[model samples]
Structures are given as structure tokens and as C-alpha cells.
Target: MVQHVWSVNELGEWLAAVRIDPAIFDLRPDYCAGLMVVAGISSGPSDTDSDQWLQAADSCDIDLDDVHLEHWRDAYRSFGAKPNRTRPSADALSRRAEKNGLPRINKITDTYNAISVLQRIPIGVENLDAFVGPARLVRADGTEQFDTTNDGLGVAEHPEPGEPVWRDDTGVTCRRWNWRQTPRTAITDTTANALFIVDALGPDAHQRAAVAIDTLRTALATGTPSATRYIDTAD
Candidate 1:
């Protein structure tokens, strides 16, 4: 559909529209995020390459002692979230890999999840077509809607006031920074255009995010006809 019909200018406009509020930086100065847009992707269920990559990530020697994981834990604490109860995405994935291993979602989602665990960064991928407006990272005012699942059924939730969240014009896409994602913009098998958000914090945050960005680019090359990367960071 529109994903197959994307032009260079349209991708540029989409990249330019992504923004991180300065007030978010006021809370965590080391916060850095790499946002990438991929068009004309060959999306489907996970195949050999994705499955192997996830297996490798699961075999990695990661634990809660990791500095990156601790950094995210601290960031969550600063935002009034209990990291032990709701861990950061990467931390949660790493923990899951140690136990039952990561779930085989889809091609794009599997690739990003593998990279997230391997690089120790929190990563999120969204179906670009589901987005209503430009994506933004900001401190929520508690008014935005977050469409998520409770138990096995769909439910609507809202972020706490002053929580760091990613949102489009419609509502929150991710809450508590990288703890949870909304099902509204989740990537699916038919998703051809995608938006990836890679997050890093603490020492070498930008460098870590850059490395994760490059890894995602290389890993997705086989499926993407064209990939564009744009990084947003705190000053």
C-alpha cells in the first residue's frame, strides 16, 4: 500500500517530524534515542535468519549486573516507576531470554528484539501506517490515551502525569519510557513501512545507540528495500 509507494521526500518529512521534548532531557541528561524508518520491507513470520539471531541473543551472557540495565533501572526509578515490577524493554527481554527465550513475533519485530538484547538497548518497532501524526517523545500530562491489552482483552490506559512517553498525534505509543508498548501501532505481518525507536541511557548513551542503530540497519538490510535513520538525543 502506502509503504510500497514511499518516496525519498516522504521519508525525509517523516524523519524530520520526530522530536524529543527538552523537558525530558531535564530529567535524564544521558537519554539518547535513534529513530529509523524502513520502507518496502519484506515482513512476515520469523524465518531462519531471525530465529538464529534470536537464539544467539539468548545465548549471550547478560544479567541484571549489566551497566546498561542498571542505568535503565535508575531512569525508571527517577520517573517514579518500579523497575523491579516493570522492567525496561531490554532488561525484560534479556531476563526472558535467560528463562524461556524471546518469542518469535515477526520478521521486523524479531530482528529489533534480537538487536535490543544483544546491544543492551531498549528498542521498539511500529507500523508506520498506523500512526496518525508525527511521533514525539515527551513528558505526558496524563490526558493522552494509551490503547493496550489487559489480560487477553483490549483495554485503554493513560500514563501518569509527568511520565516519559512516546506518542503520535493520537496517543501514547509507549509508556514509562520503554517499559510497555501500546498495541494500537504494533507491527504486524503485513506491515511494510516501519518506525524503529532505539533507546540508550547513562554513560556512552549516544555511542551505544549509534551502535544499535548500525546493527539494526545491517540486520534489516535483507528485508528492506530502503532504510532511513535519524537519531535524536539530549544536549
Candidate 2:
């Protein structure tokens, strides 16, 4: 079950030898092992806060089927999603992404809901200007186009008139996922900095998610500890 699909970029001389906040050089404390996830993926009007992510996915159990409930009802009929399912609680994904305008949570979305409540898997974080470049999570071929929190405008994630996506770019700053962005490309309250990404798939979660993203790119690649080149696409 080496379920494959891979991608990762940055480290362009360590993201141009930034300054700080690569989560303080990957916040290593033995470089984490399992679970510590926190994920918030509200769509316009906060995708009506799907019970604050279904009680953070039942405080950790992430059980959802029917092809992830048909990708949350096809992301609520392709951009207009609110009640983000797996629900009955987070106040039902936050009263359905707050009637379509739930922008307020920060820190790269609370550090991706604290790593999706600590690694239940299926992680997500967005907003590199809501994307158009640096986006290629790969897998989606139904004619991409999404983003129209009712005409505020933006669309594409399944518009296979040409086919191919799973995208999440930043090349030209945001393309479409409908509306899970727009704090001028999100991660606001002055997002000091971020780019922490992880997915860890197949073969025992791809050698422990490639040693947990090379122990977070070698404890943030500037102090010590080395060895990283992800994009292995675990087969």
C-alpha cells in the first residue's frame, strides 16, 4: 500500500538563506514520531466551518469513506462548500465555514491544525497567494476550476476540460480552490514565515515520511544535521 504521490520544493540555498522561522529550524525534539496534527481548511465563509473540522476529525480518528465522502460532496459542488462533513460537531466544521467568510484563524492555519491533530494523515495547507505556481500536488482530472464564494471569483480543482491537478501553486499566486484563501494569499497576522509541508505515503508511510521530512530538513538546515532531497514519490 505504498500509495504514491509526491512533491516538495524550497531549500533554494535554504529558501534563499532566509532569516528565521523555518519553524525555528524545524523545531526538532527528536524530530517528532507520530501524530500532533492540526488542520483547518475552511473554504469561503469558512466553508461554513465543518464542525471545526469535524471536532478535529473526532479528536483523532479521521474516519471518512465513500471516497472521502466524494471529496466533501465535490467540495460542495465545486466551490461553495461549507459543511465540510465527518461531522456532528467543531460546532458542525464551524457552523459550516461560517456562512462563507471564515477568515480569522492564522499561523499557517494554526500550524495546519497542529499537524492535523498530530498525523492522522491526509494533510493540507494552502495560500501561496492562494496559488497558481508552486502548485502540483498531482491527482485530479475532471476539468479543474473552483473559487467563487458566490462571485468573489476563483475556480478550478476539477475542471478536466484539459485535465490534471491536486495543484496548490504560487508561481503566479493562486489559481483556484474556490475560496480557501484570500487574506492576500493567506497565512496572515503577518505570517512571519512558513513552508512546512508533509504527506508521508506508502511503504510504512514512506520510510517514516522520509525521516519526517529529513527531520524537518535537517533541523532547519542551517545549524547542523543533514541529508534531504524529498520528492522521492515513494513507490
Candidate 3:
């Protein structure tokens, strides 16, 4: 049994403040692909895991290059940013995994990566304990401090003006909508509580989001047997 459930009122409040209207879909899937989250687990990827990652990457290569992806990319670009320069995290990960192999950041992270590639949608996960307060997704004013790494060195950056971001009281958790995640709330081996946000676009967005979330819930349960999962859609 899972313990500790946070109120989602803050998420609700943030959505109300955003300019872009997204179709939110709450989901609960029966089983997630064998992803697990346990304390002290190694975050390395094995050769076999790498092979599987490559296989999943291969499956999405064509879709990623075709017009299917452009629909959503165009929607994101409509927000005044170049999708290629600031492509959605899921698309970036899929492309990178296919071209250079996936980074094994532990089972939990890898699981989501696989899902993102297969589903072709952006997904964000955070260590709940790192948050200062309730989480919100709002437009960036270019002032929030984003702690991240560049060239193996830790650095601080700011989101572009008018960009959509996920934030808490401390700082921005995700920048450029779902293009990148800040290190401040990144999930790690020691992370116990996690929150996931899945992004979708286009006409069938709600259905796509539902399928992605269900896959996520199942994967999360595989790692944390006591994990409790839930979903909240926008009204």
C-alpha cells in the first residue's frame, strides 16, 4: 500500500493561469512495463538493456521522421519557439536514443524513456520531496533560476520569456514547456516519492495522454510495489 498523497489544488491553480489550453487526460493503466524504483539501485544501463533500448528506438525512427511528429512539433512551435531548437523532451530523447543509444539513468528513468519513445509524447517526472510547495505549470517571465548541468558542469539558466514551464515555490522544475527538466527536482536512486506529468498535443491528445499515463502508472508500480498512483485532468 502506498502512503502520502498530496493535494492537487496547486496544479489546478497553475493551469488556470496558463495561456495555452491543453487537453488534459487523467489515466490509470493496469500494468506498466517492468519499471521499478528502489533505494540504492544502480543507475547504470547494462548491455542487454542497451539493446532493448535500441530496439525501441528503431521502432519509432520512422514515425519520428515522418509527418506524424510534425503535427505536435508545429503546435509547440506555435508558441513562438523553434521545435527543433527546443523540441519536446520526448522527441529529443527518442532521436538521441536512436542515433547514440539511450542513457541508462536507472530503471525508473529508463522506463519512462522507453515509454516516451514508443508513445511519441513528452513526459516529465520529479522527485516530490525536492519540491518547496505545490507544483504549478505557468508561463515563464525569464527570472526563475533553473539548476542544470552543461558540459559536465553545474550551471544556472533561465527560461525564455512567454515559455510554458512547470514550477514550484523554489524555482522552475521544467523549462520550455516539456523540453527539459531542471536538476532541482530530478529523480535519483534515493528518490522515494515521484510525480509524473505527461504532455500530448493535436486532435487526439486526450486519448494519447491517457494511454501514456496508463503505461507510466504500470511501469511505476513495477519498481515500487507500495507505490500509489493517480491522475488529474484539467477541467
Candidate 4:
């Protein structure tokens, strides 16, 4: 399998160019368990690369006028978080967001939804397959296990401590489940499309996820100047 690392600049550039206008599409977010994966090309079935998706809100291109940065603040008001939980992990932060109805959004909005959230459902898409398979939600037991980080170039496997990971049946890896992707599986300049979803851990999740995915697909198809496909995670 080929390993790649997408540097912050590279990822940001992709987000900037992502088709958002002339389309009624919205970004969806959901996270569950300990997992995250990439959204595009894999050379083969055994090929799994460290996949990481950065929040579009963090990017300058995302519009925050209607929606503030903290969209999930109200979602967590009813649900209680750990008292001492300052700087909640991606898993914790996303779980709170899920309780609240995720709004229709742009690239940033759609990017992080595939993983994290209370339901723990990380969705992944490839250019071909409906949904990612041969996928496994496992974390590195210790620092000794790690995928490469995208420094804008390419990366190799290295030792990582306490770094949780989502790996495919193959050796490709990413870090912190849905939070960050290692360089190895990181999306790069070559990526044309992606398979994305958040890990889910709830009962009503499928229905909710389907609504968001379907809405996004319709919106995207209608809005984009070019044609593309969107698949529901539950499918």
C-alpha cells in the first residue's frame, strides 16, 4: 500500500477549493467509538492509509456568520460533560455536537462529521466503494505504533505513544481516531474524491445519519457545477 502525508497547507488548500457554492449541500458530522479514516483513493483492498480530516471551521474559507465557531455549545447544555474535562478530546467534543441537530453547512461542516460524537460512527468513502470496508477501529496500544504525519511531503511509519489510531486491515494508520490523521494515510494533492463519516455509538444513529447524508447528497448534486456522488453511512 502507498502511504501519504497531507500537510496542513495541503489540506487547507483542498478545503478552500472544495465545491460549496451553487450547491445546496451541507456537511455532516458524527463520531463514535475510537476511529477515523480517509475519504479517497486506495490502490487496492489491502491498502489502508492513515486518514485524517481537519475541521473546515478552522480553515479561513469557512463562513461563520450564521453559525458561530461553537455550534455544539448548546447541544452540551442539556447533556452533562465531565466536571474536570477541560480540553475535551475530539471524541468528547463531537458527542456533544450530535445531541444537537447538526446544521447544513459548507466543506468544513461536512468534513468533521464522519467521526466522533456520542454515537461513535466514523464513515469513510473511497472514489469507488459505497463505504469503506476491511476497516478496523483500533488504537495503537503505545507510542511504538504510529502512522506518518503529513508534513506536505510524504511520511513513513514511526513510534507514537498514547496515540489512539484507526487502522485498516492493512498497515495504513491515522492518529487520535477522528481527530488527526498520520502522514501515511493522510490525503494528498492527488486525491480526487473522498469517503467520509464519523464513528457512531447509538441506536437512533442510522436514521439521523441517513437524513444528514441524504440531505447532503441532494444538496451537493444540485449545487455543484460538476457532478459527484454522496453515499449515506448507514447504507
Report the number of the highest-lDDT candidate.
1
lDDT of 3 by residue, 109-217 (tens): 7777778787777777777657776666666789988889999899999988767777888888888767888887887665655666676665566666778777766
What's the ranking of the predictions by lDDT, best on top?
1, 3, 4, 2
Candidate no. 3 TM-score = 0.72
**TM-scores of the models, in the order given:** 0.93, 0.24, 0.72, 0.38
**CA-only RMSD, every prediction:** 1.9, 17.8, 7.0, 14.3
Ranking by TM-score: 1, 3, 4, 2
lDDT of 4 by residue, 85-132 (tens): 422233343444444433333232334343323223344333212112
Per-residue alpha-carbon lDDT of model 2 for 91-210, expressed as tens digits? 223333334322336433433343333333333333333333333432234444443244565543333222112344322112212223323334444332334444333335445555
TM-score of 2: 0.24
> What TM value does model 1 have?
0.93
- Residue 60 miss distance in model 2 (angstroms): 3.5
Looking at candidate 1, what is the lDDT of residue 193? Answer: 85
Q: Give lDDT: candidate 2, residue 53.
A: 42
